[model samples]
Target chain A: MRIETKTEKFDEPLHLESGRILESFELVYETYGELNEDKSNVIVICHALAGSHHAAGRYANEAKPGWWDKFIGDGKVIDTTKYFVICSNNIGSTFGSTNPLSIDPSTGKEYRFKFPILTISDVVRAQMKLYDRLGIEKAVAVIGGSMGGMQALCYSIEQPDFTDTVIAMATTAYTRPWAIAINKIAIESIRHDPAFKDGFYDPDDLQAQGLPGLAIGRMAGLIAYLSPELFNSKFGREYARTDGLYELFGRFEVERYLEYNSYSFPKVFDPLSYLYICKTMNIFDAGRNKDKLEDSFDKVKCNLHLISFKDDMLFFPEEMEEIRDIMIKLGKQDQITYKMVDSQSGHDSFLVEVEKFEDHVRDILKGK
Target chain B: MRIETKTEKFDEPLHLESGRILESFELVYETYGELNEDKSNVIVICHALAGSHHAAGRYANEAKPGWWDKFIGDGKVIDTTKYFVICSNNIGSTFGSTNPLSIDPSTGKEYRFKFPILTISDVVRAQMKLYDRLGIEKAVAVIGGSMGGMQALCYSIEQPDFTDTVIAMATTAYTRPWAIAINKIAIESIRHDPAFKDGFYDPDDLQAQGLPGLAIGRMAGLIAYLSPELFNSKFGREYARTDGLYELFGRFEVERYLEYNSYSFPKVFDPLSYLYICKTMNIFDAGRNKDKLEDSFDKVKCNLHLISFKDDMLFFPEEMEEIRDIMIKLGKQDQITYKMVDSQSGHDSFLVEVEKFEDHVRDILKGK
Candidate 1:
């Protein structure tokens, strides 16, 4: 099915966790299928870092379908024909959402550094507001992977009655040091760019330079998203252009792949939005304010499904298992389901290699 | 033993693999213990990336000893009393050696881009020249770890009669795609820094700026050199100073660790040297110019010992095992031995945790 993004302006002020007010904003989102009589078939999809609200279906002139098109279209895994799907381009995201580049009403300039730092809760709350406006009440499920998965779990914790089910894939309850280290490197890559000028860089400069800073971070993130085994298999020790081996700056096939994929990122993405969103992801902790992590989920009343890939280097299998064991230890085993997909695709498997774990998701979501 | 670095100038022209000539250069090196009458007790140590010639002994007024001081002392594993140790700072490195920042006699200016790109073979050849001048006919052994391991293995492959023993630790025979990808990211991290200015920037600027470019790459490399488990264990999810969590740049303990370690690097290290050395490391292949990898070791006469750490994420145990299997396939099993140390310290374990693998090295070197 063909789908179009819809932008709805929200005049209501959003009170963030940091006590900063987002006065006027717009939520860019998309929906699929019809709302059944009582609207029990609603499903909200949370996008990961660097992902857009475009979860499924193809736009008119797009070469490829939405990021999760294969799993959300008619007769697909989520079966848009049966369930109405809504995905909001999160605030602090560059995909037509109110972000760092969006103009502030107080002054006629972009928010830039003035944009309040965000938490995962702020992102979840913004989506919640969008859901409230869309007449989405007590939805069937909240499904997400990676940072999106954090949001999925957050929805259950913050508003236990918001969704009947929560499917979190390839993510952790709290950020680990390794993940934080990599993220810090990515942030530094952007900041060290002289053109960045402390987040006040001109859009034209990025348009011309093609995101030399963000490109480095993007390549790093892309590499982290895939297993080293997958990297070795996909692009072995072969030169894309081998004039000589001892030559300086010889191009490897993998280097070429990274360049090709990240070339167009800067043209469409705002660097400030990237910086702010990364901070949101970096500081995310589901257990904050609660004495124990188990206490954070004590009031949770939704069926929780933990999905992971064995080769996911970013959020490895052990991390996902820890969350599963925690839920089981908290005596919530009856409402929790855990599945590990044996794919060599790494963290990207949650989005790209869905076929490997679709059966598990179907069994949980569709009662198959 | 107390030691001092000695610099020897060589007027003879050196032919590089790139068909470039380095007319005049200096080799700065350090040695421990007295050479035997026959000079047969010589044990040459090849340094890894960012390492100095001082492998053992404390310099006057220095807070710490050499990088591998623990492994080599009067009665230590390598046994300075029995074997004379020599470690030469490679040509492309910083520490008082001829490098990219050194003045070129032809142009009377810093070599910078004029400095030829180096290979593992080229570095090994330079060390051979240094040995020739030092009146060392043949060494009892050549030992190294990480990039040094590549040189140790290269010594066996390049010159079959150079040494009796070649102990290589925590390294790869050939740089793989995963490694190349990371090296590319590190290169980009430096090159993208606007202050880098194509390696033409003034030294004072680097001193003043404290090498934001190199710092970013160094941080990335530091993280890669460590295992995730080690990082988690050493610096958990605690903030260094958490006044508030939602603050944009609230530092994690790991972040503080990276900043602290990398802060001192720029003052002692040259960014240009780092760039060229990383390139040398990136293109290293012990099997170069061979019909097969096994063919490269066909001429090796040394008792080769391969040492690895189980948790080395950078050069994982699998890569080291592959080389051992290759040696066995070449029918050199009797001449080759492999030992893997069960240390969770990752690639840096070779420098930091010698205790874990000292017994293996002692047995191989001392023929116990």
Candidate 2:
């Protein structure tokens, strides 16, 4: 299916959780299929870290489809033929959104480090305003995975009556200490790179010299997103070059794969945006003001579906089990459905193993 | 329990598997007790990556005891009272050994990258020469954990007639791809730091400007050494400062702990040594030339004991189980014993949870 992008500019400033305001911003988004007369057929799809507004289909000049192309087409699991699928780039994202890379109207220079820090709730609020402009009173469902899953949960809780259903995959309501620790190291890698220049380097020089730090950060993140079983099966101890044990630069296939990913990421993503999003993810807490997790979930009125991967080390399956148990204790077990998918993809199963949960996703959407 | 360090300089060139040679090198070691007649009670302990020759007691002005001081006291599990305990700093380590920080006699300058790349086997070979100089024909046992465990396994396989028992904990016969990937990123972090200057930076400047990269690398390594349960129990989501969510520099307790470790590690450790040792660890494979793992263990003549932690993500329990299963298939099960310790300390369990296996360690040592 062919896809077209659209943008809307909001002149009013956005009040952020950090008490800072984004003067004026633009939202880049894409729409698949037709919206019903009452706008009741709208299904909002949230993107994960490093993702964009392009949720599915191919553009005229693009070589590949969107990140979720496999599961969000006309006849796919999300089925654009039945519902209006809307995906917007989050405010702090680099992909055509009003991010740190955007020019500051006041100084006529890129925001960079001057950009205000954001939260997961702040990103959700920006999208909600976009929905209001598009005449969408409420979404049929919000579907997401990983960091996107965090946004879906935020929408369900903060905008309790805004969405009818919420589907979160491979994520937790609160940022885990283990996950935060890993992210902190990734951020430090970027900060320590001399070429980063405190996030003030020339845009052209950023990709060239700043790559070492960006690539290293991405490599660490990629390892966390994958399982040991997958790495062993795919790469093992195979050498990229064949001088054997004595070669200084002899590379493992796994190392080569990681390097390729690290090298390619900086070409498209902005470093400052990566840092901002990571900070937002680190501070996410559904029970920020509440004493108990159940108290936080008590305010979530949407029918909930939480799916976890068995081998996911970043967001363990036990966390989802705890969320389920909490809902049970609150006498709302009937309103939630929890499933653990047996997968070796780790936290990335939500994106890579879509076929494993195609029927379940279909059933959940059908209920809405 | 008052230990003293000793150095043995071997004038003869040491040959390495990497086809490089060290013209002359020194091995720094510590002894806890007297060597009995016939050297029948000698126990050689191999130190892990980044560890020093100081293995059991405290020095005159030292603020802390040795890394394994808790487990190697007079009446502890290893029982220094009954055994002569010797722990040597590996050649590539930053400690008082011939590492990259050592001056080259020919140039009067630090070897830096000019130093020969050493392997785990080379380190074991150097320790063997130390034993020869001490007039010890064989050791009662060789015990180590993590990289030390790798050295212990190498001692048993390569020097079958030299040791009677091998205690390998939180390690595998071969390096796993998952571990190599993590180490690859750690090395990249240091290399990307402009202050590193291709490993040619002055020592003073290195400690000042090169700290960011070193600290980030150490932080990444420290996270892998710990388990998720330990992080949650120890830190959770408590903030280091009380500005709540709005403060940009506000850190979680876990983040603060990692930062402290990263900062302090660079004070004594050398980055070049870290890179070299990590390289040695990444390329370690007992079955290097052999087609099957069982072939590698076929030459093993010493009784082997392999211990794995349930929470070790670096060296998963499955890897240790594979070693045991391979031995069982070779009908050498009688020569091998395997145990999986239940602990949330991850790979650090070998050092932190010594009490959990105190009796087992005592019994294994008594067997000799």
Candidate 3:
């Protein structure tokens, strides 16, 4: 199974949910395995915030595989051999996509804050266009977790007759207030960074400014990604190496862990992209109205599988149950299934602890 | 009952657990009721981080009373008529205490980052000194919640005979990695603010700088102080007052609520004090070693009452149960009582929803 990435350019304008337009853009995507006749074996995988189109396998020199490598490799649960996998860099994402950091051809300047707000529906629509270019008449299934899960939900509603199945894991049908509140900390941190200069700072100068604001925002986001149980078990009350607890800038092992994971994140990620993506996540409302549950799911033709992690405080398992209940109320209980994996990794379980649900996912992908 | 706040100066240097000293400081405290014969009815109340000595009563022109006004009034739970209550502003708090923003007598400049890191023991010792100044041999009880709860636990062990009872609520015996991780977010937020100026910025210029970092930090802190259920029920998916969710810097009702509470927090709070106090909390361990629980409570003479909020995610109820379990293992089951109040206010229940535990507090104070 050869793994390769290619860019597909579209000269046609993309009308966004915000009523803004992307005059022209490129979608960088990766494909694994071979597309069978008619391309009906295709499985489109959506990536979460901070993720990329490189969903599986490693590059020539990289130490780690892609974000969901363990779950999507040749003989893994997702089984690339059995399904042709396609993953695209989301439009507002920093990874090789036409994001906020991309230069505007008309003005020869980075879009930055000028990047229009995006929604899950907009992201899904762009991927559908990529599918059109790839000659994929319809995907066998659309699979995702977290923000990617939001995109999966969008795929079901936006193109009800396209895919046969939709798998959304560790996410909400709609973003909750708790999640929005957490996003505010990150936005405020970046907005307050003196070096941010209203998102117009030279990319070259970010290293000198330490991107302190972006690092802080990443740190805040990291807290929500993992759970308190994981933190206590892994780094309980431990002091940072070679530092007394009373020393200036002294850190607990947990603080050191956060700084290690987030401090250099700005060098690899775009702050404006982060800000924009968070706004998209904040406004996500798949089942737009609970009172009109039937209307909300009226267009759905795919079999829906809503997978949740029990300990995920960010998205919360109950919120997913709310979606199942809505479908049940609409007399679509037979069309939808909800599974909660007993996990302590919080929302990160879908990526790092996929073993917990690997068998179930394999079965679902098999339509068993 | 009448309430008055007065400052008591101490020429003696205060030794800290960090092996540092606060030389010749003032302890500002508010008192209610009268000292009885032998001065035995004194109830020393401890304040948490961001708290003040003003525990009860309002000024002539003020619209609201003190932080714990409901629980500490003349006929309230603590019952000032029967117990003379004393609440002191912690040394490193932003209130009227000798904090980091206070002038250093030696240099005639603000202490700023020069303030020594404090522990719950140091705070407890300082309050005991105030007792010595008033010629009081001991207090009837030491009561507090959250970080103040840390102090109540400290009083039981630090000065076994200083008080006959210790009521610690919505707090942990030691700060968990989970909590240290959250405090890290706040510290990072404040530290990254360019206006922070290495904690050397002019206090007069903070307002002009907008104190963005402090506001960001406070916003993060506010999240843990509340539970998800409260956020969901109160704000849900409501749009802000005027702007729709798609507007620039557009916000959900919950984000608006957080902004309203945290945006102006820096104007009234000192960032340096916040940094110093968080360090104290991160290192707090009342029962120093689980294996040597006996040693930690060896000289403890007070009856300990540990109260917890059911929804407290910050200082979890299980952590409080761990303390009680330790006491039970030490064969002191009869000496300690644990109470869990069902509430959705999280760690803030100890401050805002004390009504749920008022009867219990009154009974415990009455030795019932």
Give model 2's DockQ, 2 decimals. Answer: 0.71
Candidate 1 residue-wise lDDT, B270-325, digit = tens: 88889888889877777763247787877788888999898887888898898889
Best model per DockQ: 3
Q: Enumerate residue pairs that collide in model 3.
A: none
**What is the TM-score of chain A, computed separately for every candidate?**
0.96, 0.96, 0.97
Model 3 share of native interface contacts? 0.73
Provide the overall lDDT of each model, using Cα atoms, as 2-decimal numbers.
0.84, 0.85, 0.86
Which DockQ values do the candidates obtain, in the order shown? 0.71, 0.71, 0.76
Specify the highest-lDDT model's number. Answer: 3
Pick the winner on DockQ between candidates 2 and 3. 3
lDDT at A295 for candidate 2? 78
DockQ of 1: 0.71
Query: For every model in order, what is the iRMS?
Result: 1.5, 1.5, 1.2
TM-score of each: 0.96, 0.97, 0.97
What is candidate 1's lDDT per residue for A227-276, written digit by digit as tens? 88998899877676754555555677887888788767888778888888
Task: Estimate candidate 1's alpha-carbon lDDT, on a 0 to 1 scale.
Answer: 0.84
lDDT of 2 by residue, A197-278 (tens): 8888777886665467777888888989998999988888887875455544467888889988887888788888888888
Pairs in clash, predicted candidate 2: none
Q: Give a tens-digit lDDT track for model 3, residues A121-231.
A: 988888889988878888888999999999998888779978989999998878888899989988888887878888888877886556888888888888988898888
Q: How do the candidates rank by DockQ, highest first? A: 3, 1, 2
